[model samples]
Target: METVTRRRTVFDLFVIDADDTLWESALYFERAEEDFILLTRSLGFDSPSVRRLVHSRDIERLALTGYGARPYLGTLRAVLDELCPRRPSWADSAFAEISRALLEHPVILLPGARQSLEWLRERDLPMIVYTMGEQDHQLSKFSRSGLSDLVEECVVVERKTPEALADLLSSKGVEPSRSLVIGNSPRSDVNPALKVGASAILCSRERLWQAEKEDILDPGRVHHLETLSDLPSLLSFLEAAPDSASRDL
Candidate 1:
């Protein structure tokens, strides 16, 4: 598929994701993963083995437990306890502390995320924070994220599937050709929106969850950027030249 620059940017609505794309989320999860790896390594497993097993269990447990920091942390803890119950490190209170920290980590906005939101807000554009995971957890992240005041509303769901995207666009009366979905997860954000015919902007991150890794299918309506800081300019460029035709990525 040809990597295409957005054909037009005068979108009527913008649906943004709330996790690593907008703030320091996956970093915290990564930190917790490292800590857990260290703790497990102390119990006997090598670093690589621990990482592999943890990742394997994490993906496996998602189907049973769904997405949430608590569930993820629990997966790590369960793996540790199951494999190293007799190890001294397994009894350490520090392990529990690490898990709690992962669940309660602070929500810090990504660089320029706040500024970008304000830029869109000042332009009087409509934006929605559409995210998945536990309702209270996602809501809390949004509240502490300093973005709750900026978006029109926060819609939390169990999954960010194409059907959900279609429903959202349908309910909002947002034409697929005149809307954008910006997020870090191609699995949850880019693919679904593009599948539904909406343009998508993937704000790439350094450490994406394996589950979120996927190929971009409709590159004609899907694009990539390094950070949220780059968003306002892209939107401005697109909106300013709404009649512009697609260009190669």
Candidate 2:
């Protein structure tokens, strides 16, 4: 809804998500998709067919194996094979350009992310960053964003599941209720935290490829926000509420 900009003096720990929530990660992948389209077109392939084939292959691979760089790169290769049959003569150059573009893509931090982290840090709240993806890519984004130093810990988790979140909180001796998870995905971020008895702030940003909406844990226990700018007031409101205080205890 609407959030009044106010400072929150409570909250022991804040766990934030990287990728689309914190930075412009999806944009890079989107650019890669565009480059893929051009590459396929130049190779005498139909764009829609190539996309459909790759999408199907990716879904199948993700279901059977898992989602990661290997499977993703494999999906691209599969699409290339389907389009040009055993890698065309121009494949090498096209692939290199696409890869370079993806690599050189900048990580654009969302408005209010750094400010919010700094504010919480100033208030002595322990803020941690957690994301799921290839470790190298995720960490590289963090380094580019320059917010890595603001976080006490930067965790690149394999899977963003409820059990994983619970384990992390338990291992750190942080009660679930005392922890807050802020992220963009309902499936990966919000529901998992809510399932683990932690309050979640779901920043409602339009993601380019949300291939995991099929499974979302308890969707009710989430506070939806238009942007992270609303976070401060939401935290303040929650802290002022007696119910939230009891849950934290």
Candidate 3:
């Protein structure tokens, strides 16, 4: 069966999120996992045993703490402690190295991100970012990322919700109906955008956690896309939006 894709045409502003949405951030955790594996191997543990322990620990941490830098650091510490109690010296050094690396590492922007932002800049379309995190960490990333100058404004909110987005939009003179929110998480980005009458674009990432699948499948108001390059076409789609005429008129 052929499916009809809905077209958007009224959007005037683009509000994007950083972290996993714009760049390659989560791979730090993956590298930490490799460190865990090496530690387990040194302790004479097999791959299966190491995998089971790490997976179990990760699940526990997520359930208790959700996702954040501190929780991730704690999780890594726990894994190291479990695998190398006798070699506490090694664990200390490895953990320190991983933590330092994560703190300094900037996320590698996805392909076409820079070019797409440049295109939007050339068009004079107001671009902004809405993100949730510690002020220093988030702000520092933006300053170091080189994408900071491209955006007209940046909002670091305490939380990500419909009310929060609406508040930000109202303060900035951006109408929800004319704003487009682009990000990687459907739960955090799409649902909230829809609730506030803002449109959304969901850019699929390479490593979306399994728990996030439901949101992606049932995103309330979003255009699912494979890459950032699709953004130009999406903007065109919005520019060519269908006219709505009322029967009374």
Candidate 4:
């Protein structure tokens, strides 16, 4: 763990990110992409080249379609159409399988996600699972995560921007200084929190999505943790010594 400046404050609300932060999200998407690559390979396309195009298209389509399994499948379909205009009937079946696997993937929580949330709940810390993407799709995952009972609410937005974070804090009556944003994405989670004056905890993961890659805007205001399990200890330390000078952990 890494800490920056010390501040005498206790977080009133915890804004947690859903998807990759809490459960297995990007791993399923990666599997779908591998399936797409295999399909293209069977159709005589270069595997490396197909993978590159899929990644490029995926990032490019974010502005126009936003994030979600359906939109992601659309990107793959577009890539397939471009690669093989005369695709085989089997290709359709393959896509259907891929879609089913991606859309209906199980909500497997990350190690310590449940325990950490339970710890926070025991302390009466209010938490909200804040996520972005298609509302129905995101909400569906939230409902299945088994974390619904722990958090006070679940918020889904088309995109997570600085303005969106600000509005959410304002509506919740949470001061930015007294709020903590916890998530895995620098682009969507950490940066937005910094922009809105909220402290952020970056739960770094091994398999991060390309679209979520970005530099941390303000490193000093952010805490980097290896996993959710470490969160409780960090917060407990802060609560115990609010005025202690920050040091590397």
Winning candidate number (TM-score)? 4
Q: Kindly list the per-residue Cα lDDT of model 1 for residues 1-249, writing each as its tens digit.
A: 565475433778889998887778888889999998887777668999888889999999999988878889889878887787766754568788997788789998888789889998998888999998899988888888878788859998888999998999889998876788999998999999878878788888877988999988877667788888998888777656535432212
Writing each residue's lDDT as its tens digit, candidate 3 over 7-77 gives 43345678898777777666766776677677667667787777777777877877676555556677767
Candidate 2 structure lDDT: 0.76
Cα error of candidate 2 at position 200, Å: 0.8
| Collision pairs in model 4 | none
Candidate structures ordered by TM-score, highest first: 4, 1, 2, 3
Misplaced by over 4 Å in model 4 are 1-9, 244-249
Q: Which wins on lDDT, candidate 3 or candidate 4?
A: 4
Which portions of model 1 show Cα errors greater than 4 Å? 1-9, 86-92, 242-249
Two-way TM-score contest, 2 vs 4, winner: 4
lDDT of 2 by residue, 151-183 (tens): 857888878989989988988899888788988
Clashing pairs in 1: none
Each candidate structure's TM-score, on Cα atoms with residue i matched to residue i, is 0.88, 0.87, 0.78, 0.93
| Model 4 lDDT per residue over 118-225, tens place | 998998878899999989888889889888888868999899999999999999999886788999999999999888878899999989998899999878778899
Which model is ahead, 1 or 2, in terms of TM-score? 1
Candidate 4 positional error at 93, Å: 0.8
Candidate with the larger lDDT of 2 and 4:
4
lDDT of 1 at 7: 47
